[model samples]
Target chain A: MYRMASIIKTESLVKDFDGLRAVDNLNLEVEERTIFGFLGPNGAGKTTTINILCTLLRPTSGRAFINGYDCVKDAHRVRSSIGIVFQDTTLDKDLTAYENLLFHAYLYGLKREESKKRIEELLQFMDLYDRKDEPVKRFSGGMKRRLEVARGLMHYPKVLFLDEPTLGLDPQSRAGLWEHIVRLPESHNVTVFMTTHYMDEAEVCNRMAIIDHGRIIAEGTPEELKRMVGGDVVYLRAKDNKMAKEILKERIIADIEERNGEIFVHGVKGDVCIPEIIRILGEQVLSVRLQRPTLNDVFLKLTGRQIREGSPEDEFKESIRSYRRRFDRT
Target chain B: MIELKVVYVIVMRELIKFFREKSKLVSTMARPLIWLFFVGMGMSRLVPQDITGTDYMRFLFPGIIGMTILFSAIFSSISIIWDKEFGFLKEILVAPVSRFSIVLGKALSGTLLSSLQAMLIMIVSPLIGIYPEMGQIAGSVLVIIVLSFCISALGIIIASFYESLESFSMIMNFIVMPMFFLSGAMYPLKKLPLVLKYAATLNPLTYGIDGLRHILIPHGMLDFPFYLDIFVLLSTSAVFLFLSTYVFERGK
Candidate 1:
């Protein structure tokens, strides 16, 4: 059983805008100093949850706490504890990178000398020391993202919330940011709570919650989630191998899926299931291969749908439904 | 201490952006100067002296200063929507600072920019025939800064609920222009209709204009009390500051 050692916690938290609930009765426990990734399709209430925790958006009902401070009643304390990087790049285009950092430091109440030292150190860390005096409008997408991260860290917050931090960056920039994210926890002991749609980004999280329709369907380490789909995944290809999946499901309790003329089976002991699967298919088995289970599989098992095809309205409806479920459960 | 820092950061950002757009400042000042040169002189002859206790060019000075502050504050705040479009609001909101600080910072920056524009217009006002003594000039400048702060607060409140720059600009046109006309900027409040007179009483700019008039020509023929005018202006600014801060703290 997972212990409830949460730096931030929500219980039946709901956010209603007019009649619609953007975030339905959300109950989340983010552990301290962990790289907790929030995986959700767009409009799945990931941003809303972060807003509530950051004390930006007030919850319609229920309670949320950041480091044990109520999001509403103790909003000031909550804000002091958490730093957030929004989905859209927020650097002032007209200001130099150094100026932007200085401004943010001031907003966070850092003194001049300390802020200057931190800005210098952060610029060096981000490899942006030479570009510090350049206006952010002239910066590349990756450079802007790096400055934003450094700015967020200037306050030395207890928790950092990143909303789709690398959404529009290039592949190399995305990978580079991942490297920084990997070291964030170890360097600062600051809890990292982030949301991203990128599959590769989700894989590196210390723990992640796969959210769909405003509800957390699965929560675990990347390996643990993949294992939820079963330990090893086998891809069986045949000209007419329809019986392969049925045989495998009967022989071993495992998940079976088909895509592009291939049958995918997930099982705890894959090698043992393969022979039985082969025997059942007989001469029909053209080829068989084994590989790892992915977060995509976990998404598929929980939602009965792919994350990409999900519409905003569907997410809104799911959010409302989850709110009702939470209401009833409570 | 935190609020002051936030305000300073906001003001610095606003100033940097304003200075970067040299074209905007040039065009904005050019439009007012054209009016000061052409229409102000023509209107000075057409309009009577009883309306403002001086020539129309002199009357135009205070109105132009107030108008500059009004337009600057309103136009600059439309960037709140731009901030939303650019996603900067998220970064600011997520910072470990109070929302009041965010509102204060934005308002102070916009107000300071508008007040600076007003100051430039004041320097030019004398060339157009409205002269103030050095002592009066400082007090009038102080009043203009306060007026800008109050107007900027109104802008912040407007930006809080509106989502798009187009919509905000449209609303500003509808509200700001009418408020300018309805106030005694162009004519004395007493010369207008009773309905307008009462309405003008509510316009913070009315008191601002009155206060400027009092400070500029302290021994003038105006019947309105300077203390009352200053008090009303201060109170209106307080109301706006309080409301803007409240709406801002809510974070939309």
Candidate 2:
């Protein structure tokens, strides 16, 4: 139902390193001029997929095409169509921001005059014009990241691949990055493909794929995925949850779960089911609440675990997960 | 995709980076200078003129020049690991340019840097009482380029597989040290054990040192035909260049 020209398409792509498969039978399509997110925790093959599409890493089997160019056979054409910002910051710390941009422009074979004009315009757009002459080593983490993203656009690539672009940045900086990300499609005709474990960050994507253990567990627009989790969450804090849950099970035609002394009634059969729930609970119902489903709930329903706490993962990753949890709730 | 402009742009980055690290440049120049002056002068009084023709310093001068180019070529390539550690390799790898061009640019810049350092040794050779003829000076430039290209190609090949500077540096020492010593840099490839002589011949730097020796001084090793030396050096350059390019293009 989501229709736009397909900019990226992969067919049963598999990537194996040694005895392990980093990506397994991945088949995905990214529409043109939209922000597509690969939402997953660390070591879930998010970065591997991006690397294959960018032609930086070869898939063990199957094929990936970017803008109609095969990643293996037509790698050169695929490369020309896309730009990338690595998960780690890659700016030359010794070089000034302007010099870094100039060097990138040269590597991309941009004409001198055109690069100069574009460099000025890009620096202004990134709000880095004032610090263009200063060495990047002196820049803040957010500033360095912003500069790296700006450099990725030097060649005017049709598709931009960002691998955990805002990883390790503070919440404000991450939010600020989204602002630039949001402006990209408005200012330039380019599609954005990105990876993030943060649900809040994935909120920016027009469509997203939830990946786990080297496989795509679910794929759809954010709204569509959330819809899969059921429309509304009906929460009721009862004086006696055990008794209230049992009564709701028989009298209320809705799926119910209890957490922290509150009962959540999911997939309510109808709006009429809410009044029936309260009336059946009677004096045992202390309080009740209703809310829409979120992306995290969609991930939970598909993967059988939270995005951040699935298994042994990077500890710093856990920090970002907690940050997103608290920040998004606010 | 292997555009000359792309190669030039990469070479400039190498030059800019090399110039900024004044301490490294000093040490790079100093390491071989110590061997040329202290070791050459020390050996001059010990070895008779027949063993090394005129002065031992002159015989050792060409060898040191070979050493300079070889080490400069290999060490300059260690920066590739540095680039990887700093995460710049991802940017270079993901660029629209071909990996062959990227490797070409890396090797080209290493060649340029190593050749320039070899020139510094060339200039300093005269100050150490081994004056090169005008013809030898002109011809040595070609030798430096060839030797640099060959050895730099070797470094790139090693660098393509390793991501850490420490591991690559250790491996470089293990490989390059033997290649330097066994190439007749500190000794002659004359009548000796049959095995040692064959090993020296097999070493690529032997031809490079032998070529510089024939040009810089009259006491040149004519063990092989002059064309053989040129052919071997050119072939080594070609093989290593092709190999390095292939490895780099296939790399993840």
Candidate 3:
């Protein structure tokens, strides 16, 4: 028997809201000092699981532990051992950034001198030291988010949980936030547990679990999960499609299918297969292109549905519309 | 010790927010004065002096102070609903602190703010033709703190059942108006009909206002004895504090 060190562990965790199972019999183990991503679409039990682990929601059954403390029985110990950046903004917009951080420091029981020092250090690290005196209401979305990240780290917990840290940020801000998040583990010596629906964002994780319908469908490194879709996809248009299919079938031992006047060669190395297809159908080939399997393909292969169902631009616009609607209500 | 710090910081946060909203302080201070000058001056002429055993304006003084504590103390706990609406409650809930600390912090802040407002009203007691000795003023202030603590805990209990400002305000209007009218803050509790008198006796604020009258208007018409007023206020504060803390802890 072997034991792998895990900072966060859940065994057969289940949570039910009314009759609906929000988190269905789940087991998860996350190694220390690594970025662990829980990849899922909206309502896939991401936030529900995080809430349970953070001691805000009790599990319906089974158990979860953080830093060896039971989430339900030893809730205070679990809370002291973990930090969470909620999916929505939790900052007090009326308070200055420094005051907000100071408030959190006090709640976490940090001494005044130590809290002040760490507040300054974290403000600088998050690049908000210059604006620390300004009320958070005056900040842009990105600045508010960075301040929240700083506030979460004020107590120096062993694990930091970010629930969709960049859900509504612009492309530029999203990239900027990721830059800070990517360096957190190395600089702060804390394990990062984050959830995101963005497939590209999942690539940054050392290990990730693809969850859907309250169950983890796949779990591994990004590369390992993508490898589940097999080799690169080859899409080609030939002058004589039927003749090219016959010739390609006779020449190569690969699965070939024709759809909409193009032949897709599956389970073949694109670089090696592309040259051979060109030689075999020299005159019949009109255009040839190789498409590498992405996390989206892995999701599609596993669940027969697109992970993100929309382009990034479309998602951004939808988020903007919803933000505007919320703004109008307020 | 750490739990005490948690309570301190929570109170500090509310105080900082309270100071930042200068309008809130101005409005709370102004509300009691409006009732004193407008309503008190308007209604004093219609009532006979013997009914209250003093001039109507003097008789209304303690009630005005009770009104200050009632309004400010109850409204102060609305911060919980505001925190929930703004998502700040989650931050407080996720912190490694006991729910009792949070509830105590909220109740104490409300007590402090309302007591300060009531004392401000007391300082202007002369404007309403009521004069009190230093000991009477100090005793009244003690009564104000206890009453405010009780009302604030009651507010928290109501707040835990609500999640939105609209719903909270709707329910507050339903509860707060009746509480103030029935609290003997605007009338003599003894003169009410038997059923109404029983209703007033059950109100914690009635005992509080009666305590204030016992001190500030020593010769004026009084409802319960001085000891009974303090006894009721203190015991109600303890019960409310326990209930609010239990509700908060169980909410999660």
RMSD of each: 5.6, 6.4, 5.0
True contacts kept of each: 0.75, 0.63, 0.79
Query: How much DockQ does model 3 earn?
Result: 0.48
TM-score of chain A of 2: 0.80
Give iRMSD, candidate 3.
4.7
How well docked is model 2, in DockQ terms?
A: 0.35
Q: What is candidate 3's CAPRI-style docking category based on DockQ?
A: acceptable
Q: Candidate 1: which stretches are off by over 4 Å?
A: A1-4, A18-22, A234-289, A310-330, B48-53, B217-223
lDDT of 3: 0.86
- Give the alpha-carbon lDDT of every model: 0.79, 0.80, 0.86
| Reference-based lDDT, residue A175, model 1 | 81
Error of 2 at B165 (Å): 1.4
lDDT by residue (A35-134, candidate 3, tens digit) is 9999876667788889889998788898998888899999999899898898888899999999999999999999999999999999999999999999
Which stretches in model 2 have alpha-carbon errors above 4 Å? Answer: A1-4, A234-291, A310-330, B51-53, B220-225
lDDT (tens digit, per residue) of candidate 1 on A1-330: 112568878899887755766676788888898899899787677877887788766778888888877878877777778877877677888889999899888877899999999999988888899999999999999888888888888888889889899999999998887778778888867999999887778898899998765677788899899888768878889767566666666776778888888998867556776787778777888998888777887887887767667554675656555553332111
Best by TM-score: 3
Interface RMSD of each: 6.1, 7.8, 4.7
